[model samples]
Target: MNEQSPLIPTLPQGTPPEDLVPIGAPGGLDAAINPLGAELWFLRDRDGGHLLWNGNPDIWSGRAPILFPIVGRLRDDSYRHDGHVYRLPRHGFARHARFTPGAHDDHHALFRLEDNAETRAAYPFAFALTISYAITGNTLTIGAEVANRGDTPMPFSFGFHPALRWPLPQGGLRAAHHILFDRPEAPDIARLDSNGLLARSEPSPLEGQELRLRDALFEQDALIFPEVNSHAFTYTSPGGPAIRLQTENLPDLGIWTKPDADFICIEPWQGHADADDFSGDIFQKPGVIVLPPGEVWKASMSLTHERSA
Candidate 1:
């Protein structure tokens, strides 16, 4: 694992800030990504009513956001490192950090965010984070690679949050849709407390491979799976065909939606939030990925637009 991508991506001149790199397929799948957060904001499955959830103000402001450094809340929103205290907001800083366009072709776009003076003040680590999005036919694959550019190993957590249309613009009972898991899931999913910290586990509402989609299920908060047996699932709705996410190198899972929201987020994570009764050093926390100097930690998830069920 001695491969390193270029330091930055070259953006063609006259590219607008709102404009995204386009990835299209002859079968009618189209998508675009913005440099800000290296986020996938727009995804169209041929017919084009927008397959990804449109950011509704009352609901959520994110379409597909990448979570990094730390996957969830730290106790009191702060942590200690090397005998010094640091404050980092929930989900770390990757979502808010502006990534520089690395190298991109017609079907793939790579964006990189490296440690700088501003990041060092908060994170205190010299590392590089690169996110790449690729499209092949109706499939969109997102890849995140963390490189420890420093002499010491870098400890970090990573996650992916992708919200799809609940009922879809194609139209049905938001509850009519259901998530089809590749294998039978455990009867219980992990739970998070009011402060966004994880606590004791709870029995899951699911009995089989499919969990019927419903708004009421998230009345309290998110449904988290600390260790899911399968890493892939497909979302099916009568309003539209199935939208699938197949993952590699991602073991944790979360299903969440705001109160009465018309979207559901299927999140894949390499780590989770801090424990409710635990407060420890940042690098010692559970699920913290340690990358040796010059070594790379990478994960990829593929989103596919499937034919109607």
Candidate 2:
């Protein structure tokens, strides 16, 4: 993969406006990413079919919101850093932040965010976060790059939250859809308490190789697998359209959907929310990444659409 990024179209200084970066190859995947939070607004497959959730308000308002600085809810919605407590909202502020749109060369586009007064007040770290989306053939790859630009170390968590159609654009009923793992083994999922923090690891209700989708299955909220045994999985419907999700360098996975909602999210995460009983430093938080000064961290998730019968 080429690391060189194409220059994104820019707006004049002091211009009041909304800018969106569009990137994709000519004959395959095409997508639009919102600079605000660097969120993906659209994804078009080779067949010109949209595979991402359409963000209907009746089901869920969110599209694909990135989880940065944190993946899930924090204990008390706050964390201790250097003996001082910093308050961060659930899923962190990256989803709400405005990112600087970088260059795009048709096949890929980049967006960047840096620590400022607001971020430092909550994160207290000097860092730069860059996100890039690339399309190759029938695959769309999303990468998150975190750099500790300051002289001190930086600690944080990040993840991708892409909500796909429950029945899928390929067509099927929710109950008729199922997820098949590349590995035969089923991994345990940590239950969430009333507070939404991880309760304990329990044996998954999933069957040997496939987990059928059911509305009641998400009544308790997201199904989080802290110890994900499979790096890849194929999401299939009754017939035709399907998508294969591949997570590289990301270890955790979360499958979530609201009760009776039209979309379900397959999340690839680097870290998860803190445990309910735990109240510790952000650096020591479970699944947190501590990058030394001048160091960079990277993780990616790739989605491939399969329409072959």
Candidate 3:
């Protein structure tokens, strides 16, 4: 296969000392982003109640982290490509790498992360990733775009890992909250092995379109739906406010939280961890997206909060 020497694009890099970019809408929704990981560290509802998990280090300190290149763990924290093996930590490097902040305003902000020597060493390819956040009314919309600058096809996965407040600050008992999908869901789902690799298909705990939230459901770790049919779901409790999340171009979803943790992560994923029995090329990974050279792949999700009456 022939390859082209494309001109690599450059942008300002994010420096240390971890500063936060604050954005808010006239409607009262507000957010704070840390460019170091392009992570949304805070989000408040229109009524001034927090809707996102506060990264309390004692528990799980991630608010909303972007997952890319690989969604979950590999068989051995590594992958094979072009006869060479490369290593990537869980959820890939995007969550830990710096992203250069770009255009911004009161309610919108854009940040970019491009492949560098560090990235190429781990996953040999030229690519650019941009993440944008915007708030309008009571909704926060997040957009991610990945462009393959190499002449050959680039195989990768992307996902959004957002940990919203468990009881959602709108006033509800933790055990009272549940998830309502847009459609009835299947009874079976995928699970992970003790090693965190994709294990096997098992019976799902969901009952029709609803999944009542509880700590016991997570005793074995994250519940993954590799074949989710709904593009939207609502997180709420009876008579409480709700957070409705909508996804675009994301086919899989995962729900997880540390038992009794104050937050629950609703993840919309384009790909997942490697199956325990499969260890082939990166392109062969399940749910991976192959983007042709010079092409861009995009995915987005929106979160709308409904205030309690």
* lDDT for each candidate structure: 0.82, 0.83, 0.88
**Per-prediction TM-score:** 0.91, 0.91, 0.93
Model 3 residue 275 lDDT score: 89
Sort all candidates by lDDT, best to worst: 3, 2, 1
Q: Give the TM-score of candidate 1.
A: 0.91
Model 1 lDDT, full chain set: 0.82
Task: For model 3, state the Cα shift of residue 94 in Å.
Answer: 0.3
- lDDT per residue for candidate 2 within 1-309, as digits (tens), equals 121222221212222124657777767777778888899877877666677776666657677998889989999999998889999998899999999988888888999999999999898889999999998988999999999999988898999999987777666666788898777665677778778888787778689878888987788888887758889988988775788999888888899998887778999898998898889888889999899999999999999888858
Error of 3 at 158 (Å): 0.2
Tens-digit lDDT track for model 3 on 1-309?
A: 012201111212212133677788776688878898899877877666778777777777788999988999999999999999999999999999999999998889999999999999998999999999998988899999999999999999999999999888866799999998998778899999998899888888888889999999899999999879999999998889999999999999999999999899999999999889888999888889999999999999999988876
Residue-by-residue lDDT tens digits, candidate 1, 1-309: 011211112222222344466666767577777788888867777666567766655557777888988888898998888999999888999998889987777788899999999999888889999999888888999999999999987889999999887776565667778988898888888888889999878888885787887777788788898879888898887656888889899899989999677678999999999999878888889888888899999999999887664
lDDT comparing candidate 3 with the true structure: 0.88
lDDT score, candidate 3, position 185? 76
Off by over 4 Å in 2: 1-18, 185-187
TM-score for candidate 3, residues paired by index: 0.93
**Candidate number of the best TM-score:** 3
* Residue 23, model 2, lDDT: 78
Sort order, TM-score high to low: 3, 1, 2
Model 3 lDDT at residue 79: 91
